[model samples]
Target: MALLSYPRRHPSIHLLILSAYALFLLPILDGLELGGDGLYREILRDETVLRLKELGKVIAFSDEEGVRFQTTFLGSAAVAVQDVLKLNSLEGTANALGEVRYSPESVGSYVEVHIEQGPVLEALHYPLAAELVLTLETLCKEPNKFLTYDEECGCFTEESLAGLVCTVGELLTWPSASNVIPGQVNFTVDIRAMDDKVRETIVTSFSRLVLQRCDDRLVDCAVEQKHAAAATPCDAELTSRLERATRSTISSMAAGVRRAGGETPVLMSGAGHDAMAMARLTKVGMLFVRCRGGVSHSPEESVMDDDVWAAGLALVNFIDQNAVDAAAATAAESDVASGFARPHWSQAAHQFGCNRAP
Candidate 1:
C-alpha cells in the first residue's frame, strides 16, 4: 500500500504513515510486456502519451540509440504515491485519470520505522536511530576535465567543509578502452549533513570552485542538481516519547543479558526516505533498526531477529502510551469546555508508517 491512515476520535489528529514497501519500486516502462522481443525497446504507449497531454504534462523519451528501458529504483514508487494520494493535480479539479484518491482531513504526525542503511549503527553497536537529516544528490560533468587529477580533491579537503559526508557514487568516462585519455568525465556527488546551511554551503562552494577551475582550464563544465531536500527534524515531544519507549523495550530485553551502554545514539541518516517528503504534511519522526555489517540494498543485508522484535515491541509501547496520554488530554479539554476547572492539556493523535531507503 502507498499510504495507510489510522483515524481516532479526532480526525484532524489522526496519523498517516507511508509504508516502506510502497516506496521501494521504481516506475515500469510504458509499453513493454513480459516474453516479447520488444521488451528491449524503451517505448511509451500512444494512449499513455495522450493521457499525459490531456493532463497538461509533457512526456519526453530519451533519444539515445540502443538504450534498453529499465525501471528506476524509486521512480515507480513516486508515481504510485501520487496516484494513491491524488497529488500534483490541480486543486479543486476532478481527477480525470479515473483513479480513487485518498484525501484526509488532517494529519497530525508521521512516523517511519525503517532499517539503518549505513554502517554507523553497526559500527557503534546500536540497534536504533531516532533522528535523521537531509540528503542532496548532485551531478557534475566536464568534457575536457580528466579524472586522474589532484584538483578534484580540493573541494573535500577544506577545513570548513568538515562534518559533511560526500561520496562519488557514480562515475562515467567516455572511450571505455584502457590506455586512452577520457574525453568526458561525469560523476554524481551524494552530499548529506544534519545542517541545511552547511550542506548548501558545501554544494555552492564545490560547484563554484569546480566551475572556476574548469574555466581556467578552458574546459566545458556543467553542474546540475538532481535532487535536494531540507533537513527534517523529529518533533521534540514525539522523539522524547520514542526514546523512552525504546529504552524501556531494550531494558526489558536485556534483563537476562549483559549490555554495554544504556544510551541510544541519535544519528543523522545520510540516506533519503519517504519521511522527508511526508514532513511537508505533518510532524515527522523515524526509528531505525540496525542491519548486519551496515549493508543495505544488497543480497547480504540482514537484520537480527531480536532487533526486529525489539523494534516492534518498542512501537507498540509507544502507541499504547500515546493513546493513553491523548485520551487523558481529550478528557481534560472536554472538562474545560463544560465549565469545570481542569488543567489545560492537549495532544495530537499520531499516525505511523514505514519508509525504506531507495
Candidate 2:
C-alpha cells in the first residue's frame, strides 16, 4: 500500500517509487510463475472423503493443499484439541503460519515457531496429498461400471444408442494424468472406503465410464483400481503411492504470459497436497506467491515480485468467480467436452461430435 502513497514534495523519490511499483507488477502483465499450489495435492483425497460420507467411512476435513488428514476417530480427537487450544481455523492457520515463518528448535519448554525450511506450497503439497489419499483408500474399494453397448446404434447406451455425443459435462477426469506424463496417458479408477457397496459402485461406475468412452471411440480400456484393500489399512502394506502432484504445475510456470492475460484457466484442482503440513488448503489457491511457481520439491520456493502482484490482482478476479455454480458449469462443460458426432445408425461421422439430428 505504501507503494500507493503520495510523495508530492519529492519528484525524484516519487519517480523511484513508481519504478518500484512497475517492477513489482512486471510478472502480472508479462508472465506468471507456473507452479502448483497445494490444491492438486488434495483433490482426490478430499473429494473421496466427501463422496464417501454416506458410507460408514468418515473424513474429518480436506483442502486443495493436501495435508493434515485424519480418519473419523483421529479427526474427532483433533477437533477436541482445537477446542482446547481455542484455535479458530487452527488446522489451516497454524500450519500455514508454520510454513511461511522460520522457527527455532523447540526451546526448552516453550514451543518456538519460525519459518519452515521453505515456503508452504512447495514443501507440503505432495506429502499431504499422499497422506489424505492413503487414508482414503484404507476406507474402501473402487468400483468400475459402464453402459451396456448398443449393437443397433453401434454405440454404448442403456436404451437408445443413436444420438449426439452429449452437451453435458464430459468429466474428462484423468487418472494418474502423469501416466501420460513422460509417456502415453495412463488411467486408473481408485476406490476406497469401508463400505463395500460404495466401493463396488465407484469401481463399477468408473470402469463403465472408461469402457463406454473407449467403446464409443473404439479404444481398448483397462482397469487399475484399488482401495485400501489389504487386511491392514494403516500399515505400510496399505500405502497408496502417487506421483508428485506439482510436476504439472511446475512445468506450467512457462505460461506466465497466459496467466497474466487471463487466458489461463484459474481453476481449482480437485487433488490433495502437502497442505496439512502448512495446515490450510481450501483457499490456498488464493495465495499462490507467483514468483517461483517452480518445481514444488525445492527449499527455495519463490516467485518474481511482478508475479506476486499480478497474482494478487488475479486472485481477486478468481474469488469473484467462485459464486458460479459448479453443477451448472459441469452441465455446460459436459456438453462442450462431449461434442459427440451426429448420432445416427445408418452412415455418418463417428467422432465425439461429428453428426447431428436437429
Candidate 3:
C-alpha cells in the first residue's frame, strides 16, 4: 500500500494500487548509443508512443478532471564508469558517480520494441520473439601477478602465465617496454544467460578457477566485481498479450504464412540493455524484430521494412488491447462494489445467525 499511494490528492489521478503492485506501464520511449540501428529503434519507440497517445486514453485511470498520464522509460544517466572515464579526466566526475536519484516504484509492466540484434529469430524463421531475460557479469583483478615470487623456479618467468587468459577483450599489461617483466594485467568479463541460477553458477566457477590458478603459481590474486546483473524475466500475463499481438498483426501480414504455435519463440537476451536496470524497479518485457544475418552493431546489419511495420503494428495492438481489458475490469469491480451483485455466501450467513444489519 505504501508503494502505490499517489503523492498528491489530485482529482484527476486514479492510481491502480493493487497489492500485486500493479503500477505504471512502460513503453520504449527512447534509445541511447545510436549506432545505425539506434536511430531506427528510436523511431519505432517514438511512433509507438505517439500512436498510443492518439488513442485518446491513458493506461492508468484517474479520478481527477484532467490528470496527465505518465509512463516510465529507461534513462541513460547510468552509464558505465569505465566508459565515462575514457572521455573526461576523473577530476570533476565525482558527482557523476553518485547514486541515481530518480527511480520510480512498482512498475506494472515494460515493453520494448527493437531489432532482435541477434540471429536467433532469423534462424527460426520467425519475425518476432519476446526477450524474456538477460544475463551479464564482470570480473576483475588488481595490482599485478607477474611480480609474485617463485620459490622453486627462482627466476621471473613471463611465459608461465601466458595460457591463463580467460577473458581476451581489453587486457592491458603494465610496463610498456619489451624488456620488462609485466607486473600488472587487467581485463573484463561479460556473460549472459536466460536463467539467473545458471549465470550465478558460471560466475562462481569462473571466479574460483581464476583464484585457484593464481594460488597454484604463488601469485597475489585479487578479484573485483565491477558489475553483476541478474537475469530479468518477463511477466507471463503481459508476455501472453505480446504473443497474441504478434500473431494478429505480424502473422496476418501475408496469407498462408505459417505462424506456428511455438514457432515464434521467447528469447533470452545475451547482450545487456537498459531493460536490465529497469528490471530493478518493475516488470520488463521485450519484442524482438529479426536482424539480417543475426548481425548487429555493424555496417552489414540490416532489417526489412516489412518486419519493422509488423513490429509497430504489434505494439499498437498490444497497447489498445491492454487499455480495453483494464477499463472493462475496472467497470466490473465498480459495479460489484456498488451492490449490484449479491454475495453467494449471504444465505449461508443468514442461516448461521451471522447476518448483520445493513
Against the true structure, whose lDDT is highest?
Answer: 3
lDDT tens string, model 1, 1-358?
A: 1222222111011122212101111112222112211210111112122212221222111101111322211222232234322343334444443332222223445565656666666766667667644343222211122112125564433444445568887799998669999999999887766557667877998999999999999999999986666766667776777788787666666342244666766656655555555555455677777777655444555777556656655665565555456456556667553422221111111111122111
- Provide the TM-score for each candidate, comma-separated: 0.59, 0.21, 0.60
Model 3 C-alpha lDDT per residue in residues 1-358, reported as the tens digit of each score = 2222332321111112222223233322222222334345534534443333322222322211111211112132122112233232334455654442224443455565656767667776777877665543212211122223345977434543321223554578888578998898777675444445444655788889999999999998887765565666667777788888877665445532354555557765655554555565556677778878766545666887656666766665665566556556656667654322222222322332222111
Q: Report the backbone clash tally of model 2.
A: 73
Better of 1 and 2 by TM-score: 1
Model 2, which residues run further than 4 Å from truth? 1-264, 273-294, 297-302, 315-358
**lDDT for each candidate structure:** 0.47, 0.25, 0.49
Task: Please give the distance, in angstroms, between residue 335's alpha carbon in candidate 1 and its true position after superposition.
Answer: 5.6
lDDT of 2 at 125: 33
**Candidate 3, TM-score vs. the true structure?**
0.60
Superior candidate under lDDT, 2 versus 3: 3
Candidate 3 shows a clash count of: 5
Model 3: weakest 10-residue lDDT segment is 63-72
Across 218-337, the per-residue lDDT of candidate 2 in tens digits comes to 876676532223111121211111112222222334433322322222111112222221121111111223223333323444344333323322222221122122234445667663
Query: What's the distance in Å from true for residue 184, model 1?
Result: 2.3
